[model samples]
Target chain A: MKPLMESERFVRLAAPILVGAFLIGGWELACRHWQVPVFLFPKPSDIARSLMNDAPTLLGALWVTMRITFQAFLCAVVLGTLIAFLFVQSRFLEISLFPYAVLLQVTPVVAVAPLIIILVKNTQAALTVCATLVALFPMISNTTIGLRSVDQGLANLFRMNRAGRTATLLRLRIPSALPFFFAGLRISSGLALIGAVVAEFVAGTGGRGSGLAYEILQSGFQLDIPRMFAALFLIAFAGVSLFLLMAWLSKLALGGWHESEVAREA
Target chain B: MLALNHEEAVTSHEATASPSRKPSIVDVLSANKIYADGTEALAPVDLSIAPGEFLTLIGPSGCGKSTLLKLVANLIDPTDGRLQWWRGGFDQVGGEGRRLAFVFQDATLMPWARISSNVSLPLDLAGVPSAQSKPRVAEALKRVGLEGFENRYPRQLSGGMRMRVSIARALVTNPDLLLMDEPFGALDEFTRNRLDSDLLALWWERKLTCVFVTHSIYEAVFLSTRVVVMAARPGRIYRVMEIDEPQPRGEAFRNSARFADLCRQLSAWLADASLPSPVRASP
Candidate 1:
């Protein structure tokens, strides 16, 4: 009754701007007063200057990484949803195939990156496949659980109405699986970014056309800590932004029905 | 033999008075359900609910009341006895007799859907276009007194409100028969009483046949035209009592002496149903 969203008003408008300014001011002061080595931790002002100087290069690297992450993510979503549907439909398939999915998830992507790069001649496709493998498992597992988790009473009600199998799957199971699907998507977005970076790391895709991992490697070779910090910042920012994007998508899809979204807005 | 009393007699007489009428046979018959573990969930039972009469099956837990309801709904098959419907002159497979709707005790609404969409689900499955079904959904919501809560999710609603949505969903299709397995057994005293009155109002308005299952004697007495008491351990019917009350019964009727007397009779029958089988004494 008081207002639709006083809490959101406070958090969105006041909290972030204030906290961000405070951290920057504190860092500037510490750099100015304390005799901290610039190579170890560059001053916020220096880092800003370096970021401005290397804006074009950093932006290009960001674009490359983003393209890989997005392509991998799209593939993961399609393949994961298909596999989850398959698992939900047949116990035999799930029994035979689910352990392999679990094996893929548990095995470290870094350890397999070299082998993946060796097998796939194309560098970009190899990176994409590595990222897809990393991001695919959670979507399958979460969505499968969600699809199978319908209330038995409701299922019986559907049966009593003589609902066909396709109708039940489309109207009941998929919609029921949406929240879980989004949860897996949110987790996989971050993992997708990590997957891309790690695959690039192992493949050593170094050059002007290479991603941020190559930039970090280049900066390391030239003893350019500020540039390296700038590249690292870009990676972190990309991961956070992609995660927020997934969260926003989740909100759009399930905001009206879910309590999680409702609580956030409140 | 089942004899018609005054109310049923007048109703059946009026029904037969119409010309163009055909003799109605029992739609479902001689249903028996035994689980795979050799537990006879329902003993060989016979129940013949009329086309548009309200019949409540009241009993203790594990008495196969729900099992009987499920059998008639065709959710599960009877192990022994044949459950044949009179398909004579009807185009459909099992007769054009009636479609079945079930309402559970838990108000098992899909939490991901809005109340209006949830209520319209039966129509949605029956290939009714959304545009055509919207007005019916609105009417059903209005009937349940949930007119303004169409967009609210299940989590935002109170327990009674959710149950109303469930009832509205069941009634939206104008189904021929409603199989309710203790739909209001989860509500509080005040909410349950309100829903009881509302349900009677709905039944009177629609005149659909109902087979309600409940453990509460008072609820069975207040809502049902006839309460069929069932006993456990290879469950079978213990007794059946007809409530001599008018339709659209009010809360005042629930407090009436007549209502109390019926409740007492149902309670005694239920008590007898719950008791262990007795051995003959050497007299």
Candidate 2:
């Protein structure tokens, strides 16, 4: 039998979407009927109208936030991959340096934001560094696990074939590390957006092309509740989109060789 | 087919009537293996494999058949004794020209690589350019009936197909000796039987020296020119049986009385191997 087409599959996939729509619709109707205060949870319709009204400003903030997030995410991925390679290659270094990585992960970006701004002397670089620090640990840990997670039997097979360390690392270990590396990437993408926003919030850039955080702060100060909700929606959308993009990239890279991707296809 | 023809022509030209002038001797002399926890994995053992011979070591689990294979492969050093290879009056423990490839019970394929690349691994390690290794990989895959699966990944293949890919990988190096440690043990019976027959056919065609370790008597008899029966409790050889059979052994041979006789002999030897040593039993 022929399989269901993409449209049909999407329709089948829309059950949760429809439920979510119904819930939002019900909330909007209840708020309007009860004349609830707009400051405390504006209606979806009101938010959508505010989004359209301030489209240019909101889009500009989104572009700024996205740029920071992308730059930071890229830095995190490169730095994390390098650290992971080091961690896998040397046990002494891993033991000594891993706790410092954990310190970076556990220390809130808010606490570090002012310090980073003071040290870097550039607002954009400070924000990027904050986001990178926040997003790097998962990649380091996951990629390290992936590198070390190769099958022992396969290692022996390579050894018996007289494969040198470089060949083993390049041909066997790196490919094995890809899935875990991407998994970490998916998680860190969202963290990067959150980190960018938090860093902007703490840094107090004073409206010099700040991100969604500044927009939200500006609307809160101006008592524009619907506009604030609109900015929040944009941030949420960006976070979800970045996460999905990473997920898609992972599937594309690993789908040809991994069982998880094959199951998704089925 | 072209490579097989070349190998056959070479073998026929070198096939002398007398056995005195064998091309080389791969020897394991009084080898001993002892684990750190005081477990003797393998006792003193002396064995020799002739060039172009197919030998199977049959025993129960933990009989050190695999240890013996690893010792020969130089993957692990024996606690005592020596392994020697003699080629043209020169003796060496291991050298560059002696390319030895090992296939494990697990397919042990690199999960990330395409089948063609995985099969090309040995040659890659040997510094053969990818261009030079491509045809050898294709021929190896063709020999193992995996011709159309060059682009597929290991995770995409069935268990049997993955094992075939491992076999293709072992053959891709064109090594003089192939060592397999229960390579088909994990496969289902039907797949195992089919792989056994395919392996025998490939062995006959390539004239490559093979040292296979298996737990199955029938499989050992069906594939080997000689069977080395190993006993446990500080593993040592119990018996060596030579099968006076020709190439392309089929299902018909498996059903024959002669095949049953060999299987029974190996089984009895294995049983004897498992029992406590009589020298240690006296009060």
Candidate 3:
């Protein structure tokens, strides 16, 4: 029983890798057997070769997109938390401004991206702003709900202690909100990457710092389907990495206490 | 028996002990609670808590025992009348010898914090430096028999241990008045008995004034110097009974025929309290 339990994590990792490998193997064989055109659907081998050959360009594009995502995510976290704090401080403020936050989330970023680029002279700044807007809502909404979800008993305990507002916020509210806040981070991190890629697509900016989206755009125009696949692969890899990073962080912060992150024996 | 003047009863009980009595630690003068929806949680009643007294308030559900406890803790304000702390306004609370602490039904420890941190919350909230609070936290945990479990999170501990942590958190303030609202209500019977025993020892050792609320008649009979039985439907005190038992009570007192008799009497009072109030036409 102990040995089987110990091997569970390994089994979890192995199962997915096996399936992915099998699928990729089948795809390569089917394409080879049919002699499919490379332009129509790039083979995995072609995509890999393209990845190796254009390593420097693809890596640079990856870095640019990642920087934008990180920047937008950081800004969204800071501003969204501040906004949530204000919302918790007063119901009047929340009622007045929460609809606008919902409005921002509902509106399509593609439509807003072009207008933002035109208004902001720096293309990079415009892209970052667009990404930030796209990523901001989940942080706001999730954090507001979290901050308000304090245990009534704990709240009364704090009150009985004569804890001032600042002490209550810092000691009680913040700790209570952490699990929900981390949940928001897991979601918003992926959204930030999506927002960055989408904004770059709308901007269509091309230069030394052009992102993976621009690389894909350029490859499409040049009919380099293998290179386009490589770019798409990089974006997918980055999105997954961002998500995993957020999950790791959430675990680091809440693993000891939160039921969501704590490991329990079956 | 409705709205018994508990102060008078307490005075009579202590008549043989001393003539120069200390002032009541708390006074509830005509204090009552009515919710926003107009549900009367408690009817206007006057009561006083003498220092170092173990007073238990027992009632059925919706009896406002919790409401009365909250009012004493000042967690919620009474909708009418007022409560006096240390025979003065709330501003005098938290003073050197006038400190108050509360234990909730749920453990209410911050799950994210280690036991030591949770226990030290009151001190930390009071801006006491860590150097000053560390020893007090250790001492409080020791009192609750949770020493050396400081680094464990609330979730890591069992329900009984978590409740001990809650008690330690209350004790860390070195409070004169301890208001506990069914602190052991969620525990198993064995654990509840153990906690009740430990709690009585603590109260005796510290000479603390306690206003404990519980549904357990035996618990009230065993622990309190005086028990205030309350009734629901515009909740109010029904009767106040004096235990007339020896101090520092233990298993001997618990197993004695006198203990059984007292418990039986309290059980009858609780049954009476649980009956629906007499209907009255709206004014």
Best by lDDT: 3
Docking class of 2: medium
Worst 10 residues of 3 chain A by lDDT: A1-10
The candidate, 1 or 3, that scores higher on lDDT is 3
lDDT of 3 by residue, B77-178 (tens): 999999987546545533232277888899998999999999988888877889998998999999999989999999889999999999988888777678
Which model is ahead, 1 or 2, in terms of DockQ? Answer: 1
The alpha-carbon lDDT assigned to residue B93 of candidate 1 equals 24
How does candidate 1 fare on TM-score?
0.90
lDDT per residue (tens digit) for residues A53-168 in model 3:
99999999999999999999999999999999999999999999999999999999999999999999999999999999999999999999999999988887787777899899
lDDT tens digits, residue span B231-269, model 2: 878788888999978777998999999999888777777
| CA lDDT of every candidate | 0.82, 0.84, 0.88
Best by TM-score: 3
Model 2 global lDDT (CA atoms, 0 to 1) = 0.84
Clash count of each predicted structure: 0, 0, 0
Candidate 3 displacement at residue B142 in angstroms: 1.1
Residue B257 C-alpha lDDT in model 3: 93
Show where candidate 1 strays beyond 4 Å. Answer: A1-7, A264-266, B1-28, B86-98, B277-283
Q: Which regions of candidate 2 fall more than 4 Å away from where they truly are?
A: A1-8, A263-266, B1-20, B88-98, B277-283
Summarize candidate 1's per-residue lDDT along A100-181 as a digit string, tens digits. Answer: 9999999999999899999999899999999998999998999899899887888877877678999999888888888899
Interface CA root-mean-square deviation for model 3: 1.3
- Model 3 residue runs over 4 Å out of place are A1-6, B1-19, B93-98, B277-283
Model 2 RMSD in angstroms: 4.0
Of the true interface contacts, what fraction does each candidate have?
0.75, 0.86, 0.93
Worst 10 residues of 3 chain B by lDDT: B1-10
Model 1 Cα displacement at A263 (Å)?
Answer: 3.5
